[model samples]
Each structure stands twice: as C-alpha cells, then as structure tokens.
Target: MASNISYKCPTCGAEIFWSAEKGCFDCIYCGDTFTLEQMKEAGAVVDQPIDEQKVEHAEEIVDGEYTQTTDGTVSKDLVKYSCSHCGAEIITDRSTAATICVYCGNAVIMSEQIIADFAPDYVIPFKVQKNKVMEAFKEFSKKPLTPKDFDCDKVVDKMQGVYIPFWLYSGKCDGRIEGEGINKKTYRRGDYEITEKRIHDIMRDGTVNFEMVPVDGSAKTEDAAMDSIEPYDFKDLVKFTPAYLSGFLAERFDEDADKCFPRAQERIENTTRSELEDSAAYDELDIKSYQKKTTIEKTEYAMLPTWLLYTTYKEEKFFFAMNGQTGKFIGNLPISKVKLVLYSLLGGIGGTVVGALLGMILG
Candidate 1:
C-alpha cells in the first residue's frame, strides 16, 4: 500500500517545512520551529527497515503499463497517494520521493518508495535558500550577451531546491607510466648559436586512494549540468533522514549503484594516471605506455543539495543549477545575435579610431 508522510506543527497542526536558513522545520502558519531532535522526541519521526518484498513488488508493478486501483486505473509510471494533512490525492512518478501536494500545498514524502531499497544512506542539507538562488540567477542573467526578452523573475519563481541522488564511490588505484624525458640547452658562442638536446627514458609507479567521488544516480538530470556544480563538502554529510527532505523535491535513484559505478571508475583511473605522470619529473615528457588498475573498496548512496531551474528561449530549452551547499552556479545563457553584431561593429570602429590616432602620433 502507498503511504504519504507529512510533518505538522505541534502547536497548531499546520504543515511544517525544513528551513535552510534556520536549520530546522518551520511552520509558516504558527511561526514555530522544531529541530530534528525535537520532532523525534515528539514522536514525529520513526525509523523503518527496508522492505525487500515491497521493493520487488514495486519493480514488478512499474514494469507494466497501468495498474487497477480501488478508486480508478492509475498509470504504472505514476503512483497516487493521499495527502495525510488534507486527504487530497497526490500523484507522483516512480522516481519521485518527495513532492508537494498540488491541492493542499503540503509537503508529501512517499513513505514506501523511500523506505524500500531506494533509501539514501546519507544526505547534505540545503544551505542556500531560494532567495539567494534568485539573486544569483539575477547576477547570472546580467551578462551583456544574454537575450533581451529573457525574464529572470519568471525563472526565479520556478526555481526549486532538490536533493539529487548520487552514488559515492571509494577506491584505490595502482598505475604505472613510462615516458621519454627531453632536455634542450641553447648557448651562444662566438656569434654562433649552438643547441644541444638530451633524451632519457623515464618510468613512474604509484598508488592513489580516493574517497567520495560522486556520480548522479538520476538519468533525468544532464550529466554535464550535474558535473559542473560539483565538489560537495563531504564533511557536512549526515545520516539520511526523511525530515531533511521536507519542503523540497527529491528523486529516488533510477539508475542503481552498479550502473553508475563505471563513471566513477573512469574518473578514478584518469586521476591516478595523471598523478603518476606528474611524479615523473621531466622538462618535456612524451608518454609511450600507460597502464592502470582500479579496485572499488566501497560504495554509498547519498543525496546532495542542488537548486535547479529550466526555461525555454526561442523554443530551445535552457537549464541552470546551483550548488545548494557551496552556492556555485553554472548554466549556458542564450547569446543574442543582435547584441553580438552591435558589439562587433562598435569594437571595429573603436579599433579603427585608435589605430589612426596612434599612427599619427608615431609619425
């Protein structure tokens, strides 16, 4: 059975959401806040073990087209749950773990999906708030080449904080690099320049250990967009709790840890090779042969904080993302052809005037 969970203010029984600024859950209706410990003490949070049978059943159901329910027929791709706060129906796709009820405007966590095998092992709470993200987007859109008709405020309104699922990989790498080192010496003797070259074979072997290399586990997110806003501070990583997901959108991993490990392996191998090559001290090095072997020691599932916005300009879609923890923002803004032409003409005229003035002065 599908179940929905929502946190309520103890005083007024209104919906409460996690506040990034206060590091606690706040009730807008009652203006009261509660910490995770307080919520637990109040019997608001409880730990549930993974239900392996439910996980298998969910997998079977999603593999079909539709499912028959007591109310009506629902698509297997989407799951329907009733909002615990208002009894309104909440519809979500299979990947969605947390979302807001459209009718009642209450945060709903899909208890079954998250408590199954898809539960995260760790999570980084949001540090940057929506207002800060809006300010950052405003600054980002101020680039001179951006499209004139683009509306920053509209996109800001749609901005949402999400806990992106990631697979953290830890491993050790053993690698060896063989190359030729070249040295060149040039000297002037009696009005004649003499040059001498020396070349020598060099080899280096080393082992490198890496921890917490992240690869996004959701296929819906662009790989490049996720890669751009990286380097999350793992020190802030805490044990996963459903309370951290309140007031935000979250997705369960569609791509399992095994499927995402290859990317992490490649990154680890490339870094190991670079480290080995750097240890070979040489003026000019030409790598002739290289070999590497990587062994994955551990893998962990975690949810990292991110703010995402999607908009379309001239019928082309654009995406922007910010690191909720570090405030690192990245996106490709649309470049206006009209502005490019105007700037080019201005630059050409300015260059011509400067060249003429410099020519006269030198003459």
Candidate 2:
C-alpha cells in the first residue's frame, strides 16, 4: 500500500519539524525526537504551497529558498527551529524535535542562526534504482586485476540513497592564447646532419558555451567520487519539488552561494582552457609559454541531481553515487589484499608457464 509518510517522533506523539539553526528536528510540544522525514511521514506537519498572488517571484524562485514574510500561509513557508542539544542551524517546522546533525550526527534542535536561501531550481529523480546500483558495483568489482572479494554482495547491499546538492553553471567564454612552436628537420649533406628550428606566432581564440557544468556542495562527498558518475542528464530536470525528495535523504547546501561560486568559476575556466587548446594545432610544440584570457558573461547555479551511498568496510566508511537522471555509477571499491596478491601470483605463474610451453613447442 502506498501512503504518504509523516514526520513524527516515534517515542512521543509530537510533530518534529527540521531546524537548520539547531541542525535537527525539534518538538515544541513534548520535546520529542525525530528527523524531518520521520515527521513528514507522520502527518504532523503539512507544507502548503506558496500563493502566486502574494510574492512577485513566487514561481521564479526555488522552493525552500525564499519566503515572503507577508504571504498568509502558502503551500510552502520558511520553517525554522533549533536543537537544544547542539547549537546548529536547522530548517524545518517547529514541530520537529530531532535530526542528525550535518556537522555531527548528534541530535540537534533548531538554532537562532538558521536562515533561508532560494530552493533548488531543478531536481533529477532517482532513475537508477537501488538494485541496479548494487549490480553496477558488483560489475565494477569484477574487472580484471580487481580483488576477488571486491564483488562481495554484502558490500553492494550497504549502499544507501542520499540526495547530494550540486550547482551547475552555463556560460560562454571568449578566449585568447599566445604560444610558440618549434619545427625540426633533418638533412644529410656530405654525411653531415643539419637541424633547423622555426618559431611561429600562434594566436587562438573562440567562443565555447558549456551547459550544466556540475559542482558538488556537500563536503561529505569527494570530487573524484562525484566525477566518476559523469554525464548527468540535465535535460530532464524538473522544477524542484519536495515530493521528488521522497524515500531518500535530502541534504541542504552546506556551502553558501558565495562559497560555491569559485567552483563554478574553476569549472568554466578549465573548460575554456581545454576549448582553446583543442582549437589550436601545433607540432613539436614545447609550449615554451602560454597565456589565456577568458570572459564569462553569464552564470547560474543549477541543482544537478545525484544519489549517494555511504557504506563501511572493515570499519572504514566509503561512498558511492549514481547520477539520478543518467544512472551513471560512481564510487570506489575496496580491493582485498589477500585476494589481490593471490590473483597476481596466479596470473604471473600462468603467464610464465604459457610462455615456456610455446617456446618448447616452437623449438
């Protein structure tokens, strides 16, 4: 049976809304404990959509990111609470009592520092189901030179569903690069070899636009793991809806807009450099030196979708992720030391025997 979940404290019949200030769900009534998902599933808290008439940019802004202080009870309202246990920003309803702290898992309540930012402009649904993620991991482990126990089903099953926040920027760059190239020619004159060097002025410039370049916001996730799940289908993004966040843990952006801006700039600059290099052609190029100037006219923060799995092996935690829309699988798998050594020894011995047998047969 499919039913809407509620966020209520399992121990107490109190509604627990999330509080960014406290970084946990807090109960105003009984001081109970529960996360936002727990309370939302319990029918204790209800989110009323914003009324279009009240706000000028109601539809333009992302949900949870904006709040018109005067809007009379919209479908969505800015919620704030504080965890009394720990001082952390929590963003949820007043009914929320307990939630895992982003900084630390210790229970927290709403705090005073919680503030609102525009909600994500877009979201990608969990297209890659959990079972498929496990299968992908299993297949990943089976590659040649991979550990024998790398494909362990238990490790695959440990994967979890977490929605990570990412920012995507699109823009065009007009770049100019100057560099030097050398050409060498060999000629034999009376048994003498001559080499000539030619220096040329190379000027390369072009306009290249990159759409939906992704920058991860969650500090818990590493750049390498996220990059592994490349090629998210940004074309399928839908307006951010809390409904889509169902059944998975959604993490708010830990890094502020300003903090994340550098990443966007870095991605654009890197892309622009690559475009310039690709557009230019040079032979025997030592690239004595090169200088590039790029201009980014426009940029926007887009919430690219991702699913994260945090698991532990031998007491060490590791994360795996899949692009929610494109189903790109990414994460590092542990190689069993014993299995790797055994496989290498066996492969080496087998290769030596095969080589000897071939040599003997030929002789």
Lowest summed lDDT window (length 10), candidate 2: 66-75
Instruction: For residues 245-353, write the lDDT of model 2, one tens digit per residue.
Output: 4334555555655576677677677777667776656555544444544344444443454555555556655556677656676555554566545755777536564
Candidate 1 Cα errors over 4 Å, as ranges? 46-76, 348-363
What is the lDDT of every predicted structure here?
Answer: 0.76, 0.51
Could you tell me the TM-score of candidate 2? 0.59
lDDT of 2: 0.51
lDDT top scorer: 1
lDDT of 1: 0.76
Q: How far is candidate 2 from the true structure (C-alpha RMSD, Å)?
A: 14.0
